[model samples]
Target chain A: MKTLYVQGNTWLHRLSPGLKLGGLAVFSLLLFATRSPVVLAAAVFLAGAIHASMRFGVVRTWQQLRVILLSISILTVFTLLLNGPADALAVFLRLVALAVLAATITATTSTAEFIDTITAGARPLERIGLVKAADLGLAIGLVVRFVPEVLARYEAIRDAHRARGLKQRPLTLAVPLIIQTLRHADEIAAAIDARGIRGQNNRKLGEGS
Target chain B: MATRDLVLAALFAAIIVALGLVPPIMLGFIPVPITAQSLGVMLAGVILGAKRGGLAVLLVLVLVAIGLPVLSGGRGGLATFVLPTAGYLVGWFFAAVAIGYCSERFVGRSQSALVQVTGFFMAAMIGGVVILHGLGILWLAYGTGTGLSTAFLGDLAFIPGDILKAAIAALAGRAVMVGYPLLPQRA
Candidate 1:
């Protein structure tokens, strides 16, 4: 999964990923714990201001959140019909605040920095033999890199389905997509084997110390 | 834990993330849209078995924890875990494990192709749909302050599409079992 990271020299960009993630966690917890519309609206205002402080202004941020807004609208309308406008407004504000805050962090933090922080965070888990920190880092990198590739393959399969004058049947689309994906996995497995990047082997090598 | 296993886990996780890129099939009647990502959960379980499949999903959840836009409609981050739909997201991990465990039991000894396919479909439905939706409804109720019955009724619209996903997962599972049996064999 590619992050929404864009290069910028703002202070938010300069902040450590750990701090950013930690702050996001604390802020989100507070948002969920409270139900007061006044409190929630204030939180939303603060979040929006923080987002504006980033290089990407409110307009672009709102543009990127079009899908989220749509989803929120659905929930908002449901709340409106079921509960009342008051409940709907509260839900809408809460969702918008949380989503924008998250998108801002992703937009500011580079992927490499994010992965580095994750690897550093995982180092403590190695004591319990949960996972090799380095292996976890590499695996995450592989996942991030591979998501777009698989999406591309999905597009290719969909186009082929279209070319065949087939109705966009989910079943037909899924079978080929899975087949192509596993085939690609086979190739990736072979490459990992060839590169000698085995996790167990690496653990063995580390144990020699 | 071998290189190949690690690669397989990562690859399947990527497939899960990739599935999220598909535009969700929105039904006007349902609050929750039909997303392709859940199918990846079924596929992982059917193809990779319990241990690796569970790990594959866990890996994706970790990515989500750190705020990657990996969920359908580009939703992610720690906040999402506290949202109403959070149960479905959390359910993915356990559902993969359940599907994988049941797939082994259901399909492990079946000789007839029909039985095997049925087993696959049943396993996917039991784990991927029933369990996931059950948890999803509970969370939706709590999140929205709605009654449990209301939430359960609200989720009924998902049944038809979810059954289709199960069928597709079953067919795909059978095809992989025959054409490319790379999954680790477990008792």
Candidate 2:
């Protein structure tokens, strides 16, 4: 998974990822805690201010927000039709507030910082043997590594099909795709095991420390 | 989990993200589009079984949480979780689990082609369509204050499309089973 984090020296960028994320959680709760349009309007104003302060420029900011704002607009329209104007305004303000704030956090935090934060959070789960933090981190790493490779393979397969003069469909393309990926996965698992990169082998390797 | 399971699950998660490359079919009535990614969830379920399939979806959600544009239409981040249609997105994991568990139980290695296809179809419809929609519609209604009737009506537009997706996923699941066979040997 690729993050669209812009390089910045802003105050939010200086803040730790965990704090930004924690604040996002708390702020979301508070936003939903109210049905008051005035409060939510204030929240939206504050969130928009923060977004503008990030200095992503108007086009960059709109590019970040346009997709979500589209959904928010539709949601507002539906709420207006179903629940009346008062409810619609509240919904609109609340969503805009949440979207901008979340986008701000996302834009500010780099991918490495986000992963480190997530891995730190996963540590507690690891301590309980629910998962090893290393393994969980590796899984996320593998996903990021694999997405582009899979997409590239997909285009190659599509090209192959075109060369063969076969019409492409989801099932036909997907079968080969899954088979190819699973084969790669098997080889990857073997490579990881051979390198003692997981489970007890790695644990024992670090045992002397 | 074994390293192999972890790797397999991660790879499937990537596949789910890759599915987002397909342009979504936007319905004029609903905020979200009819996405191929949901079919990826079903495929993972049917191909990997419950545990791994569910993990694959969970990992995808983690990517979304980290602000990756992994969802159809490249939508993601914390706000995506709170959208009116987000219930459907969240439902993907449970729906995969439902489909996986049912397909594992209903399909057998020695089963006739007809029986296997039938089993997969039923699994996808019951789990992918029914279970996903039940959770999704309720969330859209209660969580978003859309009113149950309004939410239900809005969801009806997608049911046919979802059913079609289930059919496609079912067929793909069967094909993968024949080609690769992964659920307890996917028997």
Candidate 3:
């Protein structure tokens, strides 16, 4: 299972996670506000520079983005077929550039740093009875960690199905996958309990402690 | 404090965020862009239950709102919500809640794969698909100045894919229940 993060010691990697997160937020807003290909292209170039400076190989980035690139290609072709060449090009480039910039942020930042930043930023919301920031942070972390595992499990199950010569039946693959997933969830719940990790109350108690 | 649980939560959230990096595939016949985001939503609900599920989604949304671009097609920010897809984005919250509620209610504490799978499917379909599409289609109609019937037509393309996603969510949710039985339970 390939990790999404790129290991590097560049300026991007050196920046505080909070600052980088803040910057990314600001930039995303800018992207949403502007539909201009020129500005989008410029943002992409800057993102590329950051990635390059971190010594994350462009080829590796492309490899990670292969699915996205393929999707964009298909979408571009479809748009061209339905609409026109100019509109297709504009939408495709805008979408691709946005994706690349987002990926760069993920590749550069550590999961821990991102969570911390979010927790810190969410402090204000904690007062309104929306959620406890720490708990929210913890939950965020779990989703991040487990998504890949679920994907990997799906692949493993698919491979097992192939080995069993049940290649064409989707139900055969799906049933076992669901069954296995439940089993995994049960164990995880047990482990959490055994470790004595309480929910929101625990966080509050910890704060008191 | 169990550092492990904390670690696990962080890891799962990252997976959700990373999955968002996958671009949206435009279905030629449908207005909805096919993306892996619903998978993330389903996983969050299954793994974290209602409260944590909602939290996990909010985390990703925060990243997107702050400009991290953790959304399908790498789109992010407040402006993304204003787009035609904004309704779907907002619907993720209720979807998680729906999934979490059904999983806990139907599956109980047994963690039986059958029950878990059934519960998850129910939740995903009700929350992620039915309710989500309901909100999304309405928003699409309102935003584009199209009639409800036209909006329904545009939304039809998503039904097949959304059903497939519901199936996947069922399987994935069950797996999580089995593998990580220590997941926080409602009192």
Taken over the whole model, the C-alpha lDDT of each candidate is 0.78, 0.83, 0.62
List the TM values for chain B, per candidate: 0.88, 0.90, 0.83
- Per-residue lDDT of B53-136 in model 2, one digit per residue for the tens? 889998999888777888887787777876667789889989999998988888888998888888988888988889999999
Interface RMSD of each: 4.8, 4.7, 8.3
lDDT of 1: 0.78
Cα misplacement distance, residue A60 of candidate 2 (Å): 1.2
What TM-score does model 3 achieve against the real structure?
Answer: 0.59
lDDT of 2 at A190: 73
Off by over 4 Å in 2: A201-209, B24-34, B182-187
- Candidate 3 CAPRI grade: incorrect
* Docking verdict class for candidate 2: acceptable
Deviation from truth (RMSD, Å), model 2: 4.2
Q: What is the fraction of true interface contacts found in candidate 2?
A: 0.61
Question: Which one wins by lDDT: 1 or 2?
Answer: 2
TM-score of each: 0.84, 0.91, 0.59
| Candidate that beats the other on TM-score, 1 or 3, i.e. the better one | 1
Name the best candidate (by DockQ).
Answer: 2
Residue-level lDDT tens digits of model 1 in A1-209: 44556679888889999998889878877877888999999988988898888868667676657766676787778778888888778788888888778777877887778878888988889778887778777788788888888889889988987899866655566667666766675577667656767634654442232
Consecutive 10-residue window with the lowest summed lDDT within model 2 chain A: A200-209
Q: In model 1, how large is the Cα lDDT of residue A179?
A: 67
Using TM-score as the measure, which candidate wins? Answer: 2
